[model samples]
Target chain A: MPTKTVAGVTVDVNDEGFFTDPSQWTEEMAPELAREEGIDSLTDPHWTVIRFMRKEQAEKGTGPTVRGLGKTSGVTVKELYQLFPKGPAKIAARVSGIPKPRGCI
Target chain B: MNSQIGEQAATAGQPDPIEKVSVIISQGSLEGVYPGLIMANGARAEGIEANLFFTFFGLDVIHAKRHEHIKVASVGNPGMHMATWLGGVPGMSSVMTHMMQKQIAELDIPSIPEFVEMISDTGAGMYACKASVDLFKMEKSDLIDQVQDIITVGEFYDIAAGGHIIFT
Candidate 1:
């Protein structure tokens, strides 16, 4: 288990940079993680996706698939790419401090 | 450092092509189609262009009337965890197909038709192999509307050029 220092706090992360213990995630770390994912800033729509993903993970024990997120997160898939770039689900999950969404290959 | 600069200069004239993924679906079983569909959709989710080519038994997946009828192949499927002889029993395949469908439904996964529609809606290209179509005597009308066209293997390769090609 590798550890990363985000926001002056050490947290475990997997080889792919996904948080090993999602419970250790903090709101303050979101922006740092977002920047690391290549997004310069988090807009309201971005927060909407992050918050929706966190809520889904808390209830479902895993983040929603990209299709499910697009359908339910009030953000369309096209817009999700605009916000998160190359890999929305993985990037969003990392920024939200959750495991990669199920069925994301 | 000189080598690095040379390498950069060698490639500076042209913009990089958009990342693309080409998936070949060769089997028509429930298990086979889902992986290809999932992968294509995954590529789209990753903002990569994706194309799915159906050939051989995979043509069943694009058949307007048969796409929905794909069944799980339990007979001789080592993953079924049963006696090898039992797998050959009649009706077992259907039972296994139903079981798999139920499991997928429980996971909130869509059916094959619906999954195809969803992937197509994502701008993923769907194609059928011309060789398979000719061998099976299938016409363009036999395929789902989502299919862009029936293309030869050479054309498929040409279109899939400059991208990762995955066979499932």
Candidate 2:
């Protein structure tokens, strides 16, 4: 396991920088992690998704799929791409302090 | 240090993730179409650009009337585990297709049309083969609205340049 320091706290992470123990996450660390994922700022829509991801991870033990996010999250799929370019689900999961979603779509 | 060696060292050890994918779907069976759709959708989910080129029988996937009603082939498919003779019986293909649709529904996978919409919403390109359209005597209005264009094999190659090409 690797470790990363964010928001003045050190935590265990996987080789890809996803948190190994999501319990160690705090809201304060979100903006910093988002920055690490190349998101320079956390807007209202971004927080909406991050909060939704955290809650979904707590119940499901994994982040939602892209389709699931589009169906459930208030943010549309196109908006998600606007918020998190490149890989929306993967980057959002990393910022939300959850494991990568295992679904193929 | 030589410039050649420096360039090699700079490019050699860096990880290069797949940035794009062009999936060619040449089969029209339910099983065949789903694999290509799944792979193309998966590529977009991973932040990779994806283009789906539907040719030959695969054009049924985007056909306005046939896209929503693709059936699983019961005969000549070993994966079904039934005798080939039994698979040829009337209504067997429908039964198998219904069963497969139920299973796919249980997994929360969308129907073909819905899946196509989802992929389009993700900005993945969808194309129909011009040669197939001509052979089938189909018009532009025959395809779903999601299809960006009807292109030739050469055009597909031009768009797929520098990306992974998957034939299914």
Candidate 3:
């Protein structure tokens, strides 16, 4: 129910800053959202993860967990941490305009 | 009510999120080993630094030859929903372990060996107990390559300082 302005576009988000309705997200809004997580810019590898996350969430109705990302995202687990910093799966889901993944691992 | 309090505190920035965890696995049964592994993996998933210390029978979980073959305890486990005597029957342990493995696989949970590799790749530390290693007459080479070292309880405490310590 909470809305925030990112990239001059208003989007609904939860208390944790994850998008509540992913449909409202646009590619242009990602850089600003990534900044909120202390990432100054989105590089090629970051885009790779973000794109993979969006596709997975769109197909599965939820984002993948870290293990799933490591297994299938074409990105290794160590690389994910280096790209997304703290909490790669959760952060990637946020930047990808998906709700937080519900899996524990 | 507790959750509400936590939310309020979070909003006020009164407490920090958990930044680290140390999990001690002291048992070898399939069920016994999972809780610690799951917790350690979950911590790393959340970007929390995690360490797993395997001691006593828990070393079976890291043994080069036995790690992949650890079995669920069929006998004397009331949670199995069967008679204790029936569980003691020959082949019961294997059957139950197979069934449990299938169920875990269905849930997308990794097997013990694969899970360990995944966790290790996430930068989570894995160590074996020095006392337990000596008791079992195992050299460092006997453990899987992922284990960082054989360490004493004091060393584990040193690493676990300023974090939650969980014994399973």
Candidate 4:
């Protein structure tokens, strides 16, 4: 999956067909792929982190590195990855309700 | 039965007849809790009788002591970088919960404790699911004092069968 736009903001969704704008993602569509799979619902940190990833994607046309996001947030890369063991791309992709970003494994 | 109320005018050529609605919320996650409570409170605001059934994990919302401790899950969510974006969101899980609680507070939305209080105040009926209680090993002592009954699914159905059924 590539970047999709909603309200003019392009977000990076991944290959699982996960990252699209929420407007394009229906309630039924979201839960079918991403409910409680090693993860529960999107929490406050999720809102923060995913929004950060989208902002990065918007500015750069690609998702930022976990290290980059972590560095910016002033937390260690280990902590970032620890927080998102599934990786930021997959997590952000799911919450944005878009397809998996291309090249996500 | 908002729909039934809507239909009353069509059938009887009168204003909607004292329409009522009931909702049952089964999930207990922080995110899942408020929609049910808000809907019930909103219904009450409109003077529609709303009943809420708390079951399974949703029990946390109505718990006397656990009410304030309800937390949001951020550890392994999709878009896991929420902390990076928010720049230090505070009391997010508890805070958001409290903000919602505050809405109920200001609007006088009831706490699990207060909800029981207002059920009497507003004449709304509240109950706990007996099977869930047993499954969770909870007793009446575990619940707030206001629960009208510890009911079986069938018991919930007895009261909820005719009205609108909502599972949040």
Candidate 5:
């Protein structure tokens, strides 16, 4: 049994060993970040889009395009600003637990 | 261009001089599963300690339900038709992905689950992207068995920074 703790979230992994909540997710669950940072990371539209990306990634294991994710979630890119003034990559990085992707870093 | 890909141990703090392979598995789909899976597997057969990471769509290769159902492309993908006998049209990536999947499959291949098993059996490193896990709302329960760790892209790079990185 292997276990990792991140941001007060304890992830207990069994012998097969899977991460319950990927440890990198800290101060950035979108929802959690908003509550603590007073920055509303997961706005309605952003939530819609991120949830969609998450679903796609979970089922497919790949990230979705910002435009594609927006289209599916019924939100315009303009609405996304309220959540992540930093743009999609930041939100994607925060949500994906990726700490910003190749270009951003 | 008679260059043959090769590998040799890189001295600490020095880059690997050989053309080593780093495999990123991004699709959890049946069709998208093989490239990363088998390529990592094949690299290992050649004695390379490949780094296999599963991200976004590629994570399906390591998930429970869809691992074995992973399939070869058959549609608008232009994958089914033979541009040449037993291979795809020249210079197209889809063809290569398709052919590689088949070649690996015919070699008494295993499903994505089985492939991961073999990867472990061969001592290759395996990781899953953390951001994708959070985005996908996947509990650790969502991942397949044998994933060594869940890391952010930064963490993955901390490992990948040393070797050749490949995205499939």
Candidate 6:
């Protein structure tokens, strides 16, 4: 229930900074969220992944797994790490304004 | 400046040892293959290097002909519900395998072959045990394309040096 402001938009975020309710997300907030996730810039490849993840979450009711993202997101796994280090799926989901994907562990 | 001091402090520590994880898969069942695959994928997602060494019965997990057909172990599996006697019934293993596969599918998990490909594509090294290959009379041709090599235990250990080793 904690709220944080990103890109001048107020949204619900968990302690881990993952969005609690994805409906409040906006594309404009992605850069700010990405910065907090240790990414200073959103390259086209990053946006490609973020947009793909948002679309998948909206349609599938859950975000894609890291493997699924690597295989289908038009981004290779090696590049995924280069884009979102440490934890690509979790960080990408957080930046994309989606819930933490299930089966990530 | 505070940021300068923080940067100095960060660099003062010894460089972090490369994060490497070696996962050994010793069972061939559907349940068996997933743990190693999931862990390796998770590790790579975190920017860590991961290697999977498949040995013994685990060879089936990477076998081109068998990887896609791994079945759940029903008999003697305490996790399975129903009497042990019922587990021995003919066709029960297939029933259990189907049920488990359906449950995993409902969770949207990819099939075994898909998982192997995904993990491999993610840069995790997939190695088949040389001893198992010789014992089972399997050639390199018998393995899925994702397998990086058929390696000896000694070779696996050499690759695993300075890395965390997990047996599943």
Question: Residue B28 deviation, candidate 5, in Å?
Answer: 3.4
The 10-residue segment with the lowest total lDDT in model 4 chain B: B113-122
Each prediction's number of clashing residue pairs: 0, 0, 0, 26, 21, 0
Task: Please compute and give the TM-score of the first chain of candidate 2 against the native first chain.
Answer: 0.96
Which parts of model 5 are misplaced by more than 4 Å? A1-105, B1-20, B82-106
Candidate 4 stretches greater than 4 Å from native: A1-105, B1-18, B76-116
The TM-score values for the models, in the order shown, are 0.72, 0.94, 0.93, 0.46, 0.45, 0.75
The alpha-carbon deviation from the true structure for residue B163 of candidate 6, after best TM-score superposition, in angstroms, is 2.1
Tell me the tens digit of each residue's lDDT in model 5 across A1-105.
Answer: 576444566555433232333343543444653444245445565566656655665665554443344345566444543354434434554454432222200
| lDDT by residue for model 5 (B22-75), tens | 788776555566667667755554445578888887776777775655555443
Residue range with the least summed lDDT across 10 consecutive positions in model 2 chain B: B8-17
Q: What is candidate 6's lDDT per residue for A1-105, written digit by digit as tens?
A: 889988888889887678988999999998888887779999999999999999999999999878678768999877887788766788899999998887653
What value does DockQ give for candidate 1?
0.32
Evaluated against the true chain A, what TM-score does chain A of model 6 have? 0.92
Q: What is the lDDT of residue B112 in candidate 5?
A: 57
Best by TM-score: 2
Worst 10 residues of 3 chain B by lDDT: B8-17
DockQ of each: 0.32, 0.75, 0.73, 0.01, 0.01, 0.42
What is the C-alpha lDDT profile of model 1 across B1-168, one tens digit per residue?
A: 999999889989866755999999999888878999888888887678899999999999989999889998877678889887887788988888999999988887788998887788677899999999999999999999999999999999998998999999
Give each candidate's interface RMSD in Å.
2.9, 1.1, 1.2, 20.8, 18.6, 2.7
The better-scoring model by TM-score among 4 and 5 is 4
* Chain B alone vs. reference chain B, TM-score for every model: 0.89, 0.94, 0.91, 0.69, 0.69, 0.87
RMSD in Å for all candidates: 5.5, 1.8, 3.8, 19.6, 19.3, 5.5
Q: Which stretches of candidate 2 lie over 4 Å from their true place?
A: B1-15
lDDT of 4 by residue, A15-91 (tens): 44455444454434433333444555655565566666656666666655433454465444444444455454555
